[model samples]
Target: MEYFALTNAWLIPLMPAIAFVLIGLFFKRWSALSACIAVFASAVSFILAIFAAIAVIGSGISVDAPFVGHVIWAEAADLHFEMGMLIDPLSVMMLFVVSLVSLLVQIYSIGYMRGDKSFGRFFAYISLFSASMLGLNISANFLQMYIFWELVGLCSYLLIGFYYQRIAAREAAKKAFITTRIGDFGLLIGILLLQTVFGTVDFLELRQLLPSYIASYGTGTLTIIGILLFIGPIGKSGQFPLHVWLPDAMEGPAPVSALIHAATMVVAGVYLVARAYFLFASVPALLEFIAWLGAFTAFFGASIAISQREIKRILAYSTISQLGYMMLALGVGSLTASLFHLFTHAFFKALLFLCAGAVMHAMNDEADIFKMGGLRKKIPIVFITMTIGVLAISGVPPFAGFFSKDEILSAALSVNTPIYIIAVITAFMTAFYMARLLFVVFFGEKTNMRLHHISCFMQIPLVLLAVLSLVSGLGGYIYDFGYWIRFGAPQPEHMDISIAVLSAVLPLLAFILAWNIYVRKKWSADCIAARMGVLYTISFHKYYIDEFYAVLCRFFIDGIGRVMYFIDIYIIGGIINVISGLVLFSSTLLGKIQTGQTQRYAAAFLCGVIILLLCGILYFNKISGITAGGGVL
Candidate 1:
């Protein structure tokens, strides 16, 4: 049975991959069939993932010894690279989360995307993304992981801009792809450096070899590698600066947003760091850097989210902020807490996005929360499900997010008080914005706009996700998530009860505060905005980060590009034109000499004869002098 499970484990990725090809090629005109194909493939993969997890658990394989199935991908110049599956607890857990969420998202997209011209195309992209994410999860080595990592990026670019005809979608896709590439370049360099120093990129091999490399070469090499490796996650997970692409990514369909933010792309970065926790552990400085960066990003993202009027954009920033929490957890040496938060966040975030999709669908594609009021009476299912999601993400009790996010805050409090403070403030903002979103979108005077009938396809996924959001937190108490996560690594420190209580209470207080402002309208938001003019402007404009990037891009495109154009057109082209002109002039002179006239030919011949006679006379004089000198000698 173990052997069979290992052999078929490859099917987890292959199923969706094959589905992607079929849906793209054969089902171009058949939306229903395409959805079935994609969803079925994902469902099968999820079942297989569950079986694989059970097998791993039943086998009782310790963390030091995971079940690794290998296939030689390449071998050259004494380097052997393998592509395989690492069926450890972590990979198995991620496999389930990614596949489950992907399956749900695909099912939700069915109703959300009905009658859309590119429905089949959307399914194809989703399936392809799922396959890439699964591949990343099960990767046995860094080389294999990087290959799938790039594939995931490509999938995101495709999905985020699913509405390719829209200029905003195209621009957002380009921004997402280009922004992430900066970090990818750094990650690639880091991978090559690791290969140079350690001569291997396999996770298990690195576990054995990194210490030796560090001892022989000192900590500097690991420091460089750690930072480089982190760049990839920073880009992938939407960490600070690199995080600018995520909110714009809302241009895609809501399901695609769910996929990117909740299940696949954004979480990949956190997973990447967790997967390579050993390297960061070796470099305390790098770990600290990761921790502080995550804390700052959490605060930064939350601040921006509070000011966002667009429903999906608010969720986008929320994902960024939650991702920062994961990163912060990792930075503070709590891999389990990071992964735990990652798992729970996936469900609630997906629920939130899907709920947004339903609302948008009913409201004739309206996305602004203020424009959408009294939706609670129109779409009660969405209202209920979305409320669950709101409560979960806000860290309210019994929801999945409460347990996971609390763990991260607890981890921060134990290690760094300043980060803990930042995290707590961010948590408060998270609740405030979500509370504002819920009240503004669902509770006000009804707009008399025509509404679409809620479809079963979309409602089903929301219901399923809502249940998960409520119960997924139970994973914390059912079994020790921290223990399962840190099975192979150093044990993580326990969080203080005081820290947990603070983490849980802050968000609740923020919710009450948000309720007072947006729900009750006790104090006008506009009045508050006027009072805090500069601060509100900064938050609303997202700290001018997007503007800064625009200016930087404009400089490169206009300023430097103009210089290059000038060089090509005038300097290089002018030199070539000058040579061509000289050649043409000399040819014209030669043409004049070769005029088709007997008199001209005769003059030319006579000139040539005179020149030849002069050369002969000088040659004869020189020869005669040598001959005379030799004869006298």
Candidate 2:
């Protein structure tokens, strides 16, 4: 039964992979057909994912021993490598989350991208993204995961730069690619170190052997490896310093934003760390780093989010901040809290981005929140759905975000008081900024433009996602998310009463304050901004991070590029030129010596032979005790 189920599960990622090739190559000119193929493929994968989840759950394979589908991939010099599909609770949960969100996004794009020129291409990229993400989720080994990891990054590059004509989109895609690569480099090094120290990269095997290896190698070695491994998640999850690329990623289409933030790309980091919880668990110091980094990032991203006016940019920062919460949960030793938040976040964040897309579609790509007003009546469904999404994200009760986020806060409070404080503050800022977005975009004065009707294609997905946002939290209470993918780690302690109370109160207070400021207009946001002038200025400019990067890029990358260019043009070029000149000179001299006469060639050959014979006689005479002048003188 497990074998049959694993075989079917293999088709989960394969279906979308086939769709990507078929649509991208054959049906590209047939936009409608291409979209149909893509959506059908994704829907099939989603169904298969559902079945896989059921199978994995019913099989009752312990986290220590996942139901792995394996085939020998390589054998070299006494080493064996196998390709594997890991169907444990964690992968199964991620499979459902990814496939569901991917299918809905594909469905939503039908309406959001109707009549676009590169519609076929868009579907192709989207399908490819889904396939890559699914592959990453079920990977049985670190190497396999890394391979799929890069595939998703490639898909992100293609999707983010879907509008190839737009310079901003192209640059954003490039930035996202390059920034993530920094972390990828670290991950690669870590993987190599693991493979060197241990012959296998299998997750299960590694977890079993890691403690022994650490005992043999000392904790310092494990700390180094853990830190290296964490780098990949940091960049992918948009943690702190590497987070700059995420906001710029909004330059892509809004659906892409939903896919990257909600289903696939950014969440990969959190999923990865959770997948390898054993490594961090062994290295206590590294875990503290993860916790502190996550806390700081949560606060950092939320701080920046509050000052942004662009709807997607606000959501982008919000994503970075939320990802921080996930990492913080992991750092606090609660995989359940982290995964729970990841699941709930997927639904609400997707809803939020899709809702934003609907508004952008109506407004002819208008993204500025301050410019939008009185849209509640015009797009009432979006208003309602987006409101729910905002509430969920702000941790309002009964919404998905509240359950997961509260759990994370509780975990933090139990492990580290500082992170707990940071998380609570971030939650406050999250609500304040989200409320600001809602009130400004859906309420207040109306913008001067004819409203576009929400298409059924778009509306269906939003409605579905909103429903999920409201109900997905039930998983935390009912399913014991921590136990589901405990991966040998102990479950987080129950939520602390004080922390839960604070969590309930913070978002509410922030929401009321936002309402008073933005909707009621009783207090000016600008006046408050002026009161907190320096901080506002800094946050508004994203702490000048982009500027700092620009300067570094200009002076450092460009400088190094210039040096390489000079070497290429002068030093290497000069060597090549000298070689060419020597060849040219010799060729010219040989050309002059060439005579189109057999007799001349024969005479030259004879003369050369006579000279050689004369030299030979002189050498013989000298060797026989004869002088060069006359054999003996």
Candidate 3:
């Protein structure tokens, strides 16, 4: 307890960073030991994270900046970012979730990536990712958070492209990085503007400073900033118009997908919005827009997920859809609900992804659900774990996802009927698609290309996560911070059991519908295509969102890059060449005069001195009127 009292939360993240450096720097030399070190370091950090969370929760909102430590990062504007940690409830929850999932994934990777050539490097990157995410979670100020935000993005890029030998993996990683960077730029500007307006980036300080001006911005400036800040979440959380990178991110290893996409990186956007909920709450219109955006993304992502053939891509789009629910919770001023969903989601989604990894490991990395069938008998542990994950994600009764998803849906209904409708429809689609995936993969005839056995290590984590997915809801954690903590009064009433039952039943209906089409009736692609025509085409193509992005990228980013390349080649290079020619000519002329003779150098020096003296004398005489006037001189 004393150590917890004095220890900086920064130490939790620092340990992983140290591990990353040591493992990565000598990965090739250390090989097997490097991974062990990475895993050990992560395990330690995970333990520290739990201690930090306990300390934070026990102490409960100390505002004295207890662990303040600093170095001069910048001086001109008096910006001094201290290397410290803030241990509020929000930060504590994020620390626990991130550390727990990251530790499990790292351990699971030991089995999944057992014989890979880059195993050491893989663990190193995983450690770096854990450190960055934990740092981002506990950051005391926006600048520090932003730095770690970009660091997590960097780790995501590296991990997503870990199989650099594969072109698809590399391309997917680049797309993920570049797309998210666009939103990050918006986030950076919003943070700078906040600092300009509030004079500080510290969260507690800004929270206190913002209430007075809640009415001053007249909704215009606040809306712009709020929306700009929301852009970061849109990109990071895989919302509409910026969600293209996430599905393709399935090209990475399954373990990477489990940690980054399902449990951590993708959730950063939701965390950002929830973290700055006060700013958004001040701009009602912006919050409303966020609600609509989340609703749209949920419907859009779920619809696309319905048709995905790849097992991981289905989960990837499922993540996008589920993240939309969290965004909806945030947009509707249900920050605690969003965080609650985020917490429960970490367990279930991670369980789903890890189970997927187990299946992939058994099938020699085959991810096509169409090619996989009746795997339950072969991989019973995976089947059971995945069933729990699917049930949880489907919002079945008593499961973790049931409570969180129902809470968000209830909140959305209370906010607006339209959003509730959209959310409910998305839930139905989620169940349908997820069940469709499960039935086809585990309950059908055997169609697998090859099969192998999964290790006990991989199965254990999957089983543990599955249990969490089922029972985390029973912990009775409050989903409304204001109501639970007495920070602010609760607003409107939530929907009752009738609404919850209706919403829950919609998914079962969808499951039956999908079952009729894809399983029981055995509808072929051509038959569905013939029946649905353009509707089928649109769903299959993800409503042409990716194509729209392709056009936009071709006309804007690629076009601008080409223009800049031309300018660099023609105009800038021409000027450089001209300067180079003049320099070369002068060098040629001076080369002849420098014959390695000290006498020649002395003569040139004396000549230059005489010329300077003459010029000085003439200027003094001309300007100072000091021909013979000593007083003026």
| RMSD in Å for model 1 | 2.8
TM-score winner, 2 or 3: 2
lDDT of 3 at 199: 80
Over 157-226, each residue of candidate 2 has an lDDT whose tens digit, in order, gives: 9988889899999999999999999999999999988898777788988888987877787788778888
Which candidate, 1 or 3, has the higher TM-score? 1
Q: Give the worst 10-residue stretch by lDDT in candidate 2.
A: 624-633
Q: Native-vs-model 3 lDDT?
A: 0.81
What's the ranking of the predictions by TM-score, best on top? 2, 1, 3
lDDT values for all models:
0.90, 0.90, 0.81
Clashing residue pairs in candidate 3, if any?
none
Tens-digit lDDT track of model 3 for 13-100: 8888998999878664566787678778877877877787567556554322333334446666666555456666677677778888
